[model samples]
Target: MERVVSIDRVNNLVKKSDFISRDLSWLKFNHRVLDQARHLDRNIFERLKFMAITASNLDEFFMIRIGSLYNYIDYGKERIDYSGLRELPFRKKLLTEAQDFVRAQNEYFIKRLRPLFAENQFKIAKISDLDEDQKEKVKNYFRKTIFPMLTPMVYDSYHTFPILMNKLLIFGVVTVSQTDKKDQKKLSFIQVPQNLPRFYEIEHNGEILFVPIEEIIREHIAKLFRNIEIQSVNLFRIIRNGDFTLEESDDIEANFLEELKRKLKTRKTGRVVRIEVEETCDRWMLRILKNRWEIDEDNVFRAPEGGMIDLTGLWSIVNHTEFKDRMPDRHPQVPPLSYSEQGETDIYEVLDDRDILLHHPYNSIEPLLELLDRAADDPDVLSIKLTIYRLAKESRVTNALLRAAENGKHISVLFEVKARFDEENNMREARRLQKAGCFVIYGISSFKTHTKLMLIVRQVEEKVTRYVHMSSGNYNEDTARLYTDLGLLTTNEQVCNDVSEFFNAITGHSIPTIYRNLITAPRDMRQQLIELIRKEADNARQGKASGIVIKINSLEDRETIAELYAASQAGVKIKLIIRGICCLRPNRPGLSENIEVGSIVGDFLEHSRIYYFHNDNDPILYSGSADVMVRSFDRRIESLFLVQNSLLKQQVINILRYNLRDNVNAYIMNEDGSYTIKESTGEPPFNIHKEFYEVTLDDIQDAKLF
Candidate 1:
């Protein structure tokens, strides 16, 4: 057995102080996202899309973060948050902030977004706002479609309370009995069908009319409760605690597949953490619900005047074709920077000659997919091994792998079934792959395999060569077009060996070892990165040029943040472009004065992870799936491979440069953890999203060397 080393527990107050609450930082990131919706620079439909994105983002936040917090509070387990508040106080503060955010979100939709949408010939109509003809159409549609799907469950003395599904819009109807001598009120619930569209759309007079399904039901709900006096009807939605740790079940550690299935079923009916009720809901009805759910007023959010309970349903309108032509077309992807070839070049041939580094969305993921397609049919190919965290709904990656497996080529796949919100998709895909005779591993026992890696072995004439693909994003082709990510396709001998060994260790019982180029995690990535930072600090103290530049999605790990603080104190300039959940207190006096942190929320999600360290004059670069989060280091399995090729290294540095130069959609982090938009003082608009789309070889040649 490996000896357990006792390290000094004293962090000298670094852990508690100078850090923003993780939850609060995440909410702030959402606020940044919300700002995109408010920004008028984007097209109307794009702005609507951003608004829907924020709504979807908030739904997950409530499910995961809010749900995780109550998992402690509800069970009476004492815990402290990053903000130094104990479980009870933290819960109070967190819920208050969450309620405030919901209020602002609703206010935005009702006040600004509604008017803007109205100006664009779009209207979310109520039954009262609709003409008699439109009302009759809605009534007929409701009776034909939504009426049958709704099952009105009564909650009274004889009946039990039904299990309300999470995140579903429900109509809480309070009715009085038809024949009772004494007046009595009864509560009945009707859940809006998940299958039906959220809105009944009717094109009228060149304007798009979207009537909320709830509104239509409100108009005709009397048909369901015939002869009964409907006193009041409240439209509301509930967000249940959908977060569950694998540790909660012994069955999870034993049979993960079965436990995952069971957990998916239970997630729908988890404890109610939040209730978003229409602002006009009767107080007594609200009180009854709060009392039954055993929750305080803090748990309920009053929806704005808009009848829509869930703003995420706005995606239906965003996807509507009425304004499709008004939106800008997607930018065409240029050929990848390093490979220096067009579409006709063979991927294997290019990779054999030199490594190819791709900056995604700007550069297509086609070459990587093409490589797999060719490898699947290639007579020289022996096997293909890869790790999958999240797969696209319609995945070319999976299809290619399936074809490879069917061609009698050995395929080893490590599918992460522990990916939250993606577990069902991963599970289904993994089972499909397994049925196709592909050797599928359901991740490691306790940890998620978040690394995006693939190794293909082939032999032309008794000489075997390995081609490997590594990336910072998923194998999801759809996301590849929406997310800014970096990927490498190479035949480098050292990286290939390291990836092969990584697969061996993950698939079998052997412990993962240190690699020559790949800095793997739950073991070495954190220490390796810290050592590099300290080395730069050492260089800075010696009066040599020293700097650190990193672009990642989140930076929440305290150890890494402390190292960056230490590096800043040593006079090493640090620049960070974090897209979300940055907990580091940048630009603070005596703490992190030399460090600058900025975030860019643009057309594409800033999903890539890049680490650049100035080694005196030379620079070290790496791109990988790992973020600066503790989970990426100590909990999940991750890998960061060095960009050894000089050209590829420069390309990464250029990416960092472009990200640092981003101002249009960029927000700079302040000492207090709030973000301010990075304003350009009369400088020409230089949007990285636009610049990268049209990047040519001459542009790279003329660019100043980092």
Candidate 2:
């Protein structure tokens, strides 16, 4: 473990303290996503999808970031963060900021969506506001579907607060004892079962009416507590600290899978971070609940007027097949540019000729899946190797590997079992692969192998030839359709050989001392990035067309930020397209005057990492999984490879240009640490996603690239 240091040490190292707080920057990013929900041009259902995404994003933020802050405060670790605040003050600031964010989200939901829903003849009706027929339907649903599932848990001197599941909605019920009216009111809560649908939809004479289960409970919850006088019934939810550590024990030390299962249980009992109550919650009731939870005012949140506590339940509406016409048209994935060359569908043949660059969601991932599926059954293929960071629940990639292993081919798969939230799934897949006779390595201890890499060793005419696939995202096919990422399919000997060595370095004891065409983290990725940036600066000083363009998910590493500042100081124009947390203070005179940062949060997530350096007309482009974060550089195992193929290089360059030029869905980061939406004056509305879908690969191929 690295030593815990103060912000003084960080400032001394960087020679400046102009970085933004990581947590606050993340909140700003979420707000940017919220802006997408507010976009008038997007379809209503698509806007609702954006809203649901922001809700889910905020939930995770509270569970991880807020949870970690509490831990820091509890442990007396008063280390100042980048924003020059200690743990306690930071926690207070974040809590207040989060409260405001949730308020805006709820206001938007109520003000915009309610009218939109009503106008569209789809209404989320309250129980009291419903007509006689609708009321009867809700009453029937409460009896038939909801009544049998509810169990009201009581709390008193002998009883304790129930182990509330994380992010699950629960109702706080206040009741007066029948025997003594003056006695303290009994406090109880009924948990809403996640298995049941959160809303019940009914068709009324061509119009659809959707009603929340909570509203139904408000009318019918008295039945759960038979004899007690129900004084108040208010809806509430709590987010808990989901962060957990794996400790070594006798049984756990031997069995990591069992340990993971054990640790998952502890996550439920984690400390409560935030308690969300309805705005109409009684003052006395709120006070009593806060006392019981041992939380202060900062941790309590009141729902916005007429807004539900969790917006994730809106997904059912967003994903309804009936609403398809109201949502954006789903564009079919296009075939790769390499596919039309001599009309070849075989990835091996295409890769053998030249590298294939894939821009996902716009371009299909079928070619990569096809590569694995073919290698599994190929008689010449001898071995298959892959690194598993995250995979779909039903992964075609995993299925291909299983088939290859079943066919007597040697298979080695490293499942990073420490992947947050995906740990159990990866463990399950790892054990399943192990049972099928494949060599399954859990992970390198204390280091997550986040690199997206795969190597297939095939013997063609008694000569071993390696085929490699590297990506900026995971092997999950489901995410490929939602996240815009770059992938490379190559048979280049040096790149393939280096990737093979990378696999060996992880799965065995052999260290990769030399990498011919790849840059890996915890090795040389950071150093390589610094040198590339400095090279641009050097070129600018020597009177060459020098600039740098970076498109990444985040930028938070202090050393990297310092180097960027230095580069900007030396007159190297830098353009950063960061989709998430960016700590670097750009566009500052004498610090980073030549730098500009823009973020895009659109229909699809901008997940690909593309780093470009204008090395005096002969530009260099590299893309892989590593973000400009401290963990990616110094802790995690990451990979970034050079774009050597001419056509593929232009494809990456074109992607950067498109993102740089997008005005409708892009926001430029301001010097005040906020973002302003990029507006179009008289120019056509430019949406890179829409353009990517409309313009086919053949059209892109025909276009000239300077």
Candidate 3:
């Protein structure tokens, strides 16, 4: 298979087509997020949040994505990516481009958006502009609130340089004596106390005025050195490597909690990635910083208009009601689901007759919660097992597990503690579950268990029966309200048995191979998908109506992309709805001419992964957590369920059809990674998500009458 899709062949095809680099394409996506910040149609506060999100997203990209590239370059691995093009050496070309982009973004923010912020009555005032009364107010506020937490240090040759924390902004002052003629220059640094608010509000002329803490310190630099003429002031911020490593050692052990604590401490001193300085800084100050920090010119960034060191702090301001625009009318989820539910309704009974699919945010997640709650209290429940990759901070699912344990029902929670940003939260939940007498298993150390599965063993008559809930999203209630995901609840014995063995394999019980209804990763998912694609190719060659449709967040797995390309060559119509990074180059003759891909970026994040294959006269549909990425297919534990029910299969098909037909938010991918927004025609257009939400409401109403 690998020989068939030769690198030379792929490169030749790529050379003849338009294909943008993946990293550059990702930057364009971030630009779209920045565009949202400038969109006048959105609420002002939401736009500010978008701006903050873009900044935070870039920080992570630098820390993880770009940092990984640097490591690859350091290791001398100059191999090309899936796109068959070699990336330039890290820090050699990427650093310059990244810095240039950030400068442009900061310029837009400061010059255009800052004035708009002032018009909204949320002003960031300079300390020198404050009058006597406002200065006194600030002084009193600082003394009463900030002085107790103040820590000041002088940086000189004698004292070791102060360690700057990651992403922390600090004020550097050069205090010199006015009377001292010979040489009078003294440098002092004050670490901005992280505990204090970045913006302090003061009322003047019945309007709210705010001052940045750094600016306040700039104003008071003269007072700190009464005998000297203040030479210059500079504001600087640092970015440090946030990647953490686990090791067996005396100081920091491999225990998750201890390692997390040690990581938090070590993060401050990690390798400095970049440094941002105030634009007005003197050459001497810049030289001292670069020399002392051992930072190269490429690593230094002079902010345009003294941009905010951490734009995330804007969230605090955005949350203020006075400056925010009115929120749009939002339809709640509960009312639709409660058409016949003013009284109690058993979820199992509803699912027993037909498969119930839940599209979250449009549909209430309360049904799933209620199912868990019932299982927790019910004596008929024998056992409950779940795979938890990420959960909400205050998760009711955890609470239900605790209750189930208390009720003497065997409960197990497979907690993947390495769920990226939520590692600490998962660790905390794992500890809580362990302390509550529930069996809590840290997932396989080699691979993250990204599967979303829940199993409930209950007594039906004298026999025990199993029910399962498999979803494309986490059991996180918070994300469910924002991410578009699909959930399936069923009592299929084959699926439940497969899930049981899958969980057992992760929890230290070795299980031999067994045939199952669902496609599970790290074992058979990749091969199964490949086989399906081959079957489709055969059908297409036989002059049958053969095609494949898949919707996922990313499409980069080499084998899968090759298989899809082969299928496309065989005349199988391939439609892909990928929301993020895609390496597949379509529209090239003898390769992927029959393949087409589009993305939908709208109000809610499109996160569900669905796969559909035309099996001659029959169609096979699947919805699950696994994307076609290598991590999903060969590393993580994931599941993709086959839709056996005719109705549910049709419903899934309908969704794919709607998504493919959508033009409002859909962007078609070119042979290059760039996307073109599909233009709508004169007909009343269909917004897929909006239409789905409305249909779900109608379905709920119709189900009530029956």
Maximum-TM-score candidate: 1
lDDT of 3 at 274: 75
Q: Write one digit per residue (lDDT tens) for candidate 1, span 86-107.
A: 6665666667767777777777
Predicted model with the maximum lDDT: 1
**Candidates ranked, most accurate by TM-score first:** 1, 2, 3
lDDT of each: 0.85, 0.84, 0.75
lDDT, model 2, position 169: 89
lDDT by residue (610-679, candidate 3, tens digit) is 8988888677788899998888988788889887866566666767777887876688877655567777
lDDT of 3: 0.75
Error (Å) of candidate 3 at residue 672 is: 2.5
Residue 164 displacement (Å), model 1: 0.6
Q: Higher TM-score: candidate 1 or 2?
A: 1
